[model samples]
Target chain A: MATTAVAAPSARVKAKQSKRFKIWIGFLFLLLIAGGYFIVERLVQGLPVTNLSSITPWGAWIAFYIFFVGLSAGSFLLSTLIYVFGMMEYERIGRMALFTAIVCMIVALTFVLMDLGRPERMLNAIIYWNVTSPLAWEVHFYLVYIALLTTELYIAMREDLVRLAGTASLKGKVAKWLTFKNSTITESTKKRDHKWMKILGTIGIPLAILGVHGGTGTIFAVVQARPSWNTGLFPVIFVVSAMVSGTALLLAMYIIKKKATKQKIDHGMVVSLAKMMVGFLFIDLGLQFYEYLVGVYGLEHHHLEGLGTMMGSAYSWSFWGVQMFLGAAIPIFLVFNKKTGTNVNALLTAAILIVIGIIGVRFNIVVPAQIVPLFEGLPAGDYFPTFNEWMVSVGIAAMGLLIYTFGEQLLPIEEIQSSEKTEG
Target chain B: MLSNMLGSKNMTEKDWNNLLDTALPDVEKEMDASPFDTKLSFNMADDARKVINENLNIKDFHKKYHSKLLKEFGEEVGQDFASGADEPAQETDGVKWGMVIDLRKCVGCDTCTVSCKAENRTPPGISYNVVLEQEIGDFPNVAKVNLPRPCMQCEKPSCVQVCPTRATYKLKNGIVTIDNDRCIGCRYCIVACPYGARSFDFGESYEDEMPGYNDVTSPEYGIERGERKPGKTPIGTVRKCNFCLHRLERGEEPACVETCVGDARFFGDLNDPNSTVSKLSKSPRAFRLKSDLGNGPNVIYLK
Candidate 1:
């Protein structure tokens, strides 16, 4: 009688939860449909639809591209902290991190495709790799990194998938298809999968740091024409910032997903991860401070102009308002404050803000330097993403979310309760 | 159209030959006015056709005509023959094409910019060359200067260094060129170029302003790209001054160099010490823009 009384409320909650989930999916689909129209329009018209000119060849799409790449690199490295370094405290978030990395990479590459003047010929970058080109090497590296991520994620999910293959949910159906026919969740199979996960994650650390994100930074740093980006510290800052954004994204995702499903918030993990994310941010800001100091102290004209544009011109709001205040100061305060630091809700807001702040950072990185002309007398570039560009970015980002959402529903991205106690 | 097609389709080889015979002028009569031997001209023509068709080796043809041409043409062919004796196909070798612009003589008229547009048929927003005008000093003491900016065709081009597909490369003659067909239109080259010499062809045409603007595209790099249309090789790719490569091939100066109203532009082989550009490059007054970056710009400026 007591069990029936308990089951009744639980059933109602489950129904309510499923309905909410459907609405979320429907909302995303509507956005996708809306964004799809503009995506098609931009593709048909080509790059002229955007405000990008020869002077400012890259704009919002590139900023977002690098932003997503940073997220992917940061999250993958965070996953490595668990899988490779044996940090069991963060084990629950490991698969989700790997999955987010893959999703973010897809979004980043899609942005890159959208930015290309001739999107159809993108394979030419890969087919004819100029060995000296960091962009070419990055193209190859991103593919390898994606492949490595997928393999690691698959191995990480192996035991769960094998266990789920006999069940009747959508995830079970996917598990049946994804797993080997006679796959078993034996102790030996578990050990092998764990070993493989460790091996792949170990390889991924350097690949993510140097080949993926650092290489992306090098794409800007190697441009001697843009003195603001030409410093050696540029790539290092990129790796560090990736850590800041990555940890924040995972923290926010954990909280949001748990809230949506009405699960118990992992307060300890959230607080600890928030601290680590802030620590990384402090380091990122220090490096960035030094980077700007050296650039200003050098007193190079183009470099100064770039910094002026980023910090003192019309675009300065993005640098100070969004990147520093919202992205850094507020988050740092929230994470450190006595009352708010341990609060799950406060930490969630801080995580989301940092992610948004990193977007501002990315825009500051890509745009301001180009605003200062390459030559003294050449007309300086004026750029803003057209409505079409914004819509296309919206569409691409919506598409990534759809993939992640469906992937979560159909795969074992979330931690299985049975394995958690045993593993811990 | 069908009738025209059928008429040509039905014409036999013998009929075509007969028609060709009637259409032709009398070769002997035409040659009668010339002082040179008609037999020699006819023999040379046939052999030249053979050389063109690869039926006879050009070296052997040159050997056969060497003495006769020298005997007939005298001092002209003697000098030409002596100069052209070695490396007949390699005249451009050791000839690093460079341009020396005398800024003092420039009036900022933009004639070179105009002529460049007309010659290259570059669409709107795509100028291979532009004259940058600047005002120096504070308001009352200001002095105006006109700098005609063209592609530097650098020895170590940053564009070539950063291009992902190796689609753009420096040629043997020192002109940096683009394989537009291979360019993915990533525009990385534009960002990497310190001089801002490159422009992206946004597939724009001047159809609204002028009719038939898209009817012809300049045979840039001597490749006969048919028209300036969307989805074409150069339409969605990075483009820059190639020193008018096709014009250079035809033994003509770049349109900008030829049409400079101030007579400020000099185009010549920099490797030849006697060339005017070579001498100007050696002048203390001559300097390259952004020389500290080590691009080794072939475009020299004499102030």
Candidate 2:
């Protein structure tokens, strides 16, 4: 396996690279057309163009927002395992994890901007800081976190960028511009980058867990009006599930990207990553179980109604079908079963299932809590995302995928095979 | 000017002091000419020390000096102090705003709804208040309850808590206000409100039904925000009942409370125990909607 480092990125990498470029371009064109339609509709009719109403104030946009945030937090946490904790076995995915984190954050913020009633006044959230509001705190945390992630990412790639700066390709040009003229790869510079990466990763661990995603969860959980969301454990579940989704997404992306480029898969690392993903999933499931159990045991009418709306109502398919079956059952089976557990294809399927299932989890979190009437006499909300809302969400997600695809094509995200051996 | 008067006063220590001081000899002439005994006057002066300098209650001071002051200053001055000190029993003033609604007085005709819309000139889908009609019990025995829902304007408003921009907050006067200029219109406040009191102004209007519906924006919070237009302040913002703050500024009651033909709405300061709302709030029949939520809503209802 150590000798395999000498092979380099062979003919397989080159062939797959050209095809992925074409796929990326086609996807981008489709996203542009879809985006153009929704943009015009949104401009003309405002928010009424979607199914959103005064009752269901948050919908697909919010779900997508949390989804992307989970991805970002998950990927960043994985990157932390390598940089901060010095987990050498998982080091191959470190920079790639950072890159994915950055892309996911971009996508998440875009969803929020699209969802705003006054997108033009989005800056007002920053201009007027409301210390009491969790959303306000989230806005500030996001800005600071983004800057840290970018700086850390730049440092992580500095050596590679310096090396690539001399090449002839467009990526080489980007590297040249990014590195500046006086760039040098020295032992001291490596030490400096390594030290900074540790510091940033250390800071980011808490910021991501407590500030970014947990605060995002708090934005909902703090609302006493929504009984389902008003729990101390809610934000904890949010962070844990974020780890679940993040690990699944990164693992899925790593394998899919390698396979598409015909690069050799790191079998041991994938198995370990899969194990970590399932472990996080089990923990997330335990938290969710307790959350549901407590809600059921309380038997408070509103809590019961909310739980019923999630588990047994017309919309329960999202629970049983997507959230439970696809998100948990199928992925758990694929990972644990003796026959399919080791196969790369089966693990990939499990990874994709987990990603889709998490979307179900996010939807269930938001919609079920809201569908139950807040008061006895008030009408229960009946909501489904309108076509425009679904299309807009799809378009945005496709746009994110396109960017990630193109980014992988240009960046040196794939690791230079490490030569160090543990021969006894 | 008073040196001649001091000369007439009998003094032991005073006499020695007066001899060294620059004063006329007849300073106490009127006091010496008094028919009352000098020893009596000296004894009375000593007692006046206890009354004036010591810890004497003013009532006791009046009781002790009543006869003496009356004999000396006559009836008019003493009587003047008595009435002046206790003029009028304390009465609080100013507009302590309040409202009274009789559930027995209400027919649930929805007149308040029409009046509120007309007064506020609200755009389409934005109702400040509404009467929710629900039937209770079975078939022949069913009874209809016409519950009119308005902004609770809770002392602990959920809308205020979840507002990301501090766009919405509660005023000391018991009114909840939203600064449309500051509202990012995330509608999180709307969702968080248990009362279902909030509405998002999706920039819709009755332009097809009415010619000038979009031609004017309501002057909320006393600011004449001018014409309703796309991307305007209130157009893409959250709105709800403010007890008609603009109308309240004009010394008028809220249009819903005023125009309820059934007269079932009550409004006023819950702070003043003597206020109509305060008195009504204490009634055994008076209870808040969802009192268990701990929102401490200002609005109270009579069953």
Candidate 3:
């Protein structure tokens, strides 16, 4: 399989980017090595190596878990807009979104696994399926969602993969193996793939909303013990915040990749995406305001205490400074202000800020509510992730990035067929 | 005046007997007409008096009837009949288990907390039950209240509601139970419980200094998970008070109730109005933890 592909000299030619590619590979290798060290340390010492306690049972790991789940849900939702709803304007990102959704889910589930006390028994969740548990349902949902994402992604990339299979480059060789030797690209196949994508993406929308992200929120909201998290509106807020982070991530990734590759930036698309990102942010903030207002107005001691911890306590900086000021305020202003709104650089900044801000948002959601104890005498938790926990998180994230980079390099993720046909 | 409207004085033993006889006529008739069991029933009725009066081993009565009843009915003969190993599975009456903790009687001695640990042999980070003591009001106006908290064992348990795998569930009888083997140790149930009744077993233990702490025994869900080893059945799972169901199965109260120095905790069937727990549950001072949340907590407290 490896040799036959290397023997071919086809119409597709390679460009000389070896030196730059080698340097990038070196950097990624360094990250992987460093990350591997921390991952090992965490495994050996157990969760005690992290600063987590019973009070703040979840900290950065749980925050990161929800963040990635949001990314998966958001990307899948965006893909639905393209492939399912037939939004032709957004066709370019369809396959990429599906792939991103799948990868993000892997990352999310990995974070959950890392956070567990017994990682070896992870399969217990599947082996003993408890239908009543939302977490159990999520485990099943994730497996199904990943399967759907994989099938949808394969279909979305099929034609491009078939086109690449005929070329002589390493990527082409990889693409050839991806498609069975007898697999042909035909009009009917295209139509069939399109029909399936629409069906899967359509089905995926509710599954992403109700089963994945909202269910993630239900994991928190249903805990009537935590007053800050115990509200009907909480899950809705989670869905909205997911959109905020997801759109920002895709927008940032698209712009950064296009700039890096010296490809033409779709200014109109960039502006529209930024507007959509901010639009979700506003709705997210509005929902949060009402949520906070209701919590504050009720004067329930625990609820107030939770809100206080988020807004006025030591970690309030994360809520006000990171979540609101950096994540919401700056991005909203940059996207809406006359001088910055249309500028691509400014929009990119806002998108990046929103992405980072959503991290703060996720952290605030998990930590502060826990900071306020269930009952008064039960010690209030004090937690911030240790250096080891932070490093392991970074390492896991780098591992995900490496997977994405290698995936893009090997697969026909880009819309090459459409571009070539349009050129003709 | 309000008591006069619902006074028990107007009711007699005959009236109570008639009420029971009418409510459960079939069982009563079975009792009256069992020719093969006539002498035994009459003796049981007589011994039931001495057993209540002289405190005879109820286990003896159960042993005497265990075989005969199995031959005739293929099952146990009483409502609260949790017998030999197989009996819990054949619980035909569908007991909705509940616990009533009288806070007014609690002295905050942490006996329930210690007994729970001793009974469950919980690891360092996990306590299936704990007593939460808090002081209300300011300096001069303050009252030191000892609130011994066990799981509320809610009828609509939030932990059960949000559990993705349904590893935790509300039993037919009100007890909320966890299937530890199935749990992912995700601690979702711990997070979701309103009572904070649940705890995650982080696998830390007293085995390093305390000999045999890790050697043997974790009688969880009535299955003895031998050895307190790390990475075992309950090590990563979520755990909470099951009203000491294993002990309850042995016709005993929960460890917390049994060990409470103040005699504050009462364990019984809330379904039985004549049970000490039910009558105590109706006292004017009766209250529940977080009553406003409407979890319908089976654990009632006397203020």
Candidate 4:
């Protein structure tokens, strides 16, 4: 893939490319600085800087935490389609998915750290280990899942690393340091790598579904105090929506990267991935329909109040405008409509919208349930992320993107060869 | 004529005694007609007179008759009678402290709320107790209900169940205490508390309004956290009412109970069936908030 995209360019074109890259990095670095300033302020000032109250103990940080966790789990599950299930068509994005999952997990954990009032005492969650608490369980699972992701990414890159190790470029230098001196790509070595990838992918599938994302959902579901989150189906919705966001994110990244690098856009993969993303969105919408339908029909006071807050209250724009219309409906239409579905740019837009929609879904999930007063006669919670919270979040997200860009620059993330293209 | 005779400065002691004996009901005759225990009744009557006269202390009076009453009425009734006069026993062993608030008597004064703040020295945005006031019904028929809520000290505390660090836990005495030192400040416990009784100490202070506001911290759970500061144990951790364990340790009622303007709140050992809280909790009017959730709240409310 690099050879095909790298056909000798003129010096002017190379300079333009390098200048554009510098500008992009510069832009991201400035965001990092701005965000970093707020993060430090938040750290010094504590959670007081955020709009969080005892009534709404969790706000944007937790919302973003779950959002990124979903993204990570979604991307890892997508990679499983190639490594575990032998979906050759998606193999081009396979390594990208794994790397994205790792990056998203880092971002997710960072959000959690920001949310903690005593960030220094975070280790107590591990040291004490309350098995009953779903949050505690999630903490353990996240660590284990991250380790598994790192290991799997290494194995997936073993062949690529060996190939790049022979070159003198920066990627080759990093590859030389990563690979063992005796590392070779024989037929058996290839078979062994493939086997390990399958084994790890199989293990990761359950881990992601049951332990990581599902466990993240369990953190909320077991909160019987919140009627909106106490259902068994909540975790399932989490995993499904993760798939939607994960696929959308990868589709967006793939298209955006291809355009940026001036490489041939894998139009077929782009269309197929968009369809897969929308399919997950439809399932997510259906599950959410029943989730709300059952909650409404139950007529339980807190549950109904929670639903009312999400659907009709001041925050309903997030539900109707962002989550439903832009996130789900538009994306579904774009993927299914023949003309737009085939248009690469249109599909890209749908993918980006879906990713943004999932953010709305996550915020809706976390905030509304808390905004409903735990008991009648108590003050109803009012919360919106403060400027500090938004800035800190932007900083953290930019930091994740920066890490991804650096990783792409240094590692053999891009495929060396284009495999057989499956028709979309 | 009797007043004139008594006013005579030289009224002799024997004459005064004779006058008292004649004026009062015949004690011997009364005791003889009452029951078979005339001797014991006569002794009690004499002691009662001495008590009224302030010649003997009440503790001695009860102590003197304790054995006789036990012999006469058997152990159970005897114990009840003895305890009625004796000071309440300071038996903390196996004690489950509980509260029963009479909502009708609350008056919506917010005194409990204020006194709790002063007593606990909780920072801004952190109130261990609050009165939830609402008007029920509509228009002319409306009735205001004042629900003074403190930590329920739930038997099955959802906060305890969800605390990943076991920092929040139910003590043997039924009060749920948070170990701020061990807490990760995750706020999961706050989310899990059904009563909305928990607060994350966001390190906000009234220092602007009252200088030296952070000079001394409330000794919550008997842990003497000296001063409030950023990143302190409680400053960044979750906190809730421990039923004022420090007060309980010193044999005082919770601040809310002591300062309630309406005299609505009763706090005592729920394990002691004879305690005021236990009796109040057994009343037909007594109920707990969100009892359907089955947390077995130690805080009972009288409607």
Candidate 5:
């Protein structure tokens, strides 16, 4: 009777855990089905089904596309800080950063595909190779950046994969398949993997800054017609904001995963990461302030109109409420306030809010400029994403989360040993 | 009898000839008074009579006397004569098509807008051209300005510069054309156009209100896009004015030019210095929209 009582509790606990997991899977599956139906309908009916018109050709999908691109670039840059710059303190989330970057890139590209009126002709952008186009350049850069990220991630994981290869679990099987049959866990192989990671990470710095994220910013910056976007400082702001979002995402993911798995949270690392994220945010704000100040002072009609739309229009709440308040102010406070700075939960909230805030920032960047008519006498565009748009976005985001979860389960994403044990 | 015959509705051929012979001066005497050859003039007169009777064409007569007429007149006049005679084979080399809109003449009737829509067969929300009407200054001292806007066909078109696919391009004739089959409907061009000239085809049709609206598509850029079905090449692509190239191919003016009530719009090859647009473009009152931006718009507006 005593043994039955002891075993029954454990069985109940297992059932509870599985039920939680099943519910999560069910939620994602439901999102996918709902989103999939709309996506198919969009393809069948074309862009007419959306609220988008000639006046507002780009809407929610484009906003989400750039948003995910920012996230991917941000996270990849964070990983580079760890591997290339020998920022060993932030090494715990290095692999997670790389993995998050890849997942975000997938989601971003999916958003772009959905935005395209003729999604079938997407490959034509590559096949026809318009060298003058910043967008074409971005497409090529994305592909190369993704390849580089995958390689860097693999090298980072070699030691862990080699260690896990001997087990009889799913991760073990994946690790065995990924590594060569004759791969060994020797001191020399470890040194070699670390050396390769450093080299790739060093190469990745320019690729991420000048090619990936900075290039994404250049796509908007090179638009000479939109005077607000036509500036040299825009790309620099993109890189800085990417650093902020990337750090916050990794911090949130790390803390949340630890809590979920009932593992020990690294409070010191979490605090330090939150500080770094705020530091980047401050720089981004400074640059943006100057950008807006110069644009306003220029007294250019179109530039003023664009800024007015972003700051004073109906959607200004996204800029003032979400971007400034939740994304910037609260997160900065959470990181700086003596009471909340050290609290893991508070820091986690700050990190999540910052991530969401960056999304608002991206929307502010893409939507406002488009809403301002290119000509003065023309009617201004009014756009809010439709129900179908929100649903598809949720589906795409859920897909990215599901990918991240599966990747973590099948890969050695978590820290295998305590910091002290590793040091020892 | 002469007054009666002159007033009569019916007159015999010999009687009409006799009346013309009596009324007209002697042709041989007039020809001999000036110019080179009497026989050439006599032959021309004979050919003119045949031409009047529909037995010989005027073009054939010109061809028969081309060299003789060139010789009778020297280099400058000779060149002018030859060009006037060979008007059908007008030289299109170095042609830069341009438009000159006389704003003072425009009545803001939206005739160009309606005609452009009919000619282009553009779908809902896709206007290839528009006329912006606004009253400037305060209420006490207000003046309404009507600006008919078309594709500027800029020398450095921002749309062409930003297009991820090079589906939109400028022809040597200064008309900017979109290869709808190649366009992926990204609408980047629409966003990049400074003049708000480009539009995206969101697949909306006039079929809801106008039956058989999609039966035939406009032959834009001289390509006969047959039907206006959903998911068709242009139905899901970016679109803009191509100066009615199909009409230009048949030696007809753009629909906007043909149908303008005030005759405010003029279209011609600007490369020809003697062309009407080229002359108007050089006028002191002529200016381009946002000229300081240096896009070098082919569409000129006369203030």
Candidate 6:
């Protein structure tokens, strides 16, 4: 798919691209409608429409919530590497990362709303804050983090938004609406924008790590009843895994979007980013290894039971098949292999696989510990998300992609075109 | 009431005492057995009865008892008395209700579980109480231990700690209560509870088996919710044992405690050192389930 897209003639691609976007959007709309039906059915009937029970109160929705939150945190932190730390080596993808972070956060919160049994009352989490609850803290942190991300993205694109304000294009209308009429690409304004981006990015670093993603990990880790998640290392592991997923997603997105538009792929940046992603994965795996080893060695019954449920029980296939082989080992081999390591298509494949693998990681984290009943002699939870859950997830994901696609077109999400850039 | 309405309000004080004594012969007998003056006990009990009925000021009773209690119990009780005994009444009056279950005496007939179901009127998938039957050892050496489980109502309740909204909270009486109206049905409390005490109300009903099952709710927490309906406050929210709070408000024991056939369960105010529950809780034989986790479960069990 990557080769064909890259090999396509520019004139033929341009003719078909507009129609393709329409068809893609139409397909996404159908999925959204279908999923919306189940969403409404769930709301009206309450939680009974799904297979969720008291035994496993959280299901696929929770897993996806954490998955997207991890993605958002990871992507935001990656943008910090470019804007804050001045790693201009990978500057081309900086705006994309920030935009992806925003979209991913929207998707993550949608998943949370879907999972809520009383979604309308969700604001109560804010109104009546139980300061002890990690979940409550996460709600507040997510809001502030999203606000910071939007500000950073806006500052990063301010120069482009100003430059495009005079054009007759659709993007021009949006650029005019977004920027002040007097906005200009002067050296002073450019300097001001850069400074603000740096400041926001610097603030965002801790917000993404400790407040967003690490706090998400704390939601699970603080549950003393689930000993496997109770370790201090759990939040650290979550931060590392976020880096892994974020880098992989951005690398894949950059490659796909470039190939679709028949633009030049920055081979040096792709290769280096892929290497960094795998590096983060290795660290993540090492931390998880120690987490498991310590948990097993301590011989706590529930911890052991949780590990057993994840690795050896009926749920083990997801652990070994999706997360380890597809998510880790194969991606590592593809990135490290001599012939394929430098290949753009292989790296893209590796990136996509890692994203899927992290989804498996999320499911493994949420479901296994719950499967082991809280007490001995009690019935263990048996959970598989119903068709309604899958539909809701698919719909929410399509909504995120649609937003990203339109965002790319309407805003200067890409490095502003060279033709347009020369004028500015 | 009809006689009073007919303007025949000329009952003498002696006549009223005769009527009260006749109406509650059992209470009269119990109060008479105590060594302290029975007249003072009756007077205090009479004032407390009026207080429960909301007919008299509770502060008036406290003021009346301040000097009398000091005079009767002597200087030993002075410390507690002098510390503003005239203060307005407390919400449960320093009572931390707890339970002690003797495993040796429990026959595991599941009477407590059944009574809890009947009293709470929980749906098919939800039970406020359950007796877990676990077999110890292996083969011929096996011994069965029936662990009757209910909400621990912990001093530091894990559910209360993790609740996103302060919907679920530990009342002053030590019963952890869920204000269903405020609950968002996030189920974080269910996930956090170490004892697995909480359940999501799925709006399921025994209506198919017993007609009108959804007609009326059990007035849990003394709030009279009329019907069991889909997507109601509790239907989408979480539910758990509030130690039969409605029954407690009526000055009656929880249905489970009342129905324990083995007499294994003992319920009283743990804050009162003289209460049976407090004494049993201190016993070397008494141990709480997973006490080391530091939730400080109020439910104690004796081997």
Task: Give the DockQ of candidate 1.
Answer: 0.54
Per-residue lDDT over A178-212 for candidate 4, one digit per residue giving the tens place of the 0 to 100 score: 99756998999889999999999999999999999
Candidate 6 per-residue lDDT over residues A90-137, each given as its tens digit: 888999999999999999999999888788999999999999999999
Q: Give model 3's share of reference contacts.
A: 0.57
Best by TM-score: 6
lDDT of each residue in B1-303, candidate 1, tens digit only: 747855777877886777778889878988988898898899999999998888997778777777788888887874455333574575646789999999999999999999999998898888999999999999899999999999999999999999999999999889999999899888999999999999999988888899998988899999988877767778779999999999999999999999998899999999887899999999999999999999999999999
Each model's DockQ score: 0.54, 0.46, 0.37, 0.60, 0.49, 0.56
Which window of ten consecutive residues has the lowest lDDT sum in model 4 chain A?
A415-424
Ranking by lDDT: 1, 4, 6, 5, 2, 3
- Residue pairs of candidate 1 with colliding backbone atoms: none
Estimate every model's Cα lDDT from 0 to 1.
0.91, 0.83, 0.81, 0.91, 0.86, 0.90
Could you estimate the TM-score for every candidate? Answer: 0.86, 0.84, 0.81, 0.86, 0.85, 0.87
What is the DockQ (computed on Cα atoms) for candidate 4? 0.60
Estimate candidate 5's alpha-carbon lDDT, on a 0 to 1 scale. Answer: 0.86
Point out the higher-scoring one by TM-score: 5 or 6. 6
**Model 1 CA lDDT for position A384:** 83
Docking class of 5: medium
Tens digits of lDDT, candidate 3, B50-167: 7777577666666565665666555545434444435454345555566677776788889889988898787787777777777889989998888777888897877877665567
- Model 3, A280-349: lDDT tens digits are 9999999999999999999988899999999999999999999999999999999999999999999999
Off by over 4 Å in 3: A1-17, A186-188, A417-424, B1-98, B170-174, B208-212, B216-218
Off by over 4 Å in 1: A1-9, A418-424, B1-93
Residue B218 of candidate 5: its Cα lDDT?
Answer: 86
Lowest-scoring 10 consecutive residues by lDDT in candidate 3 chain A?
Answer: A1-10
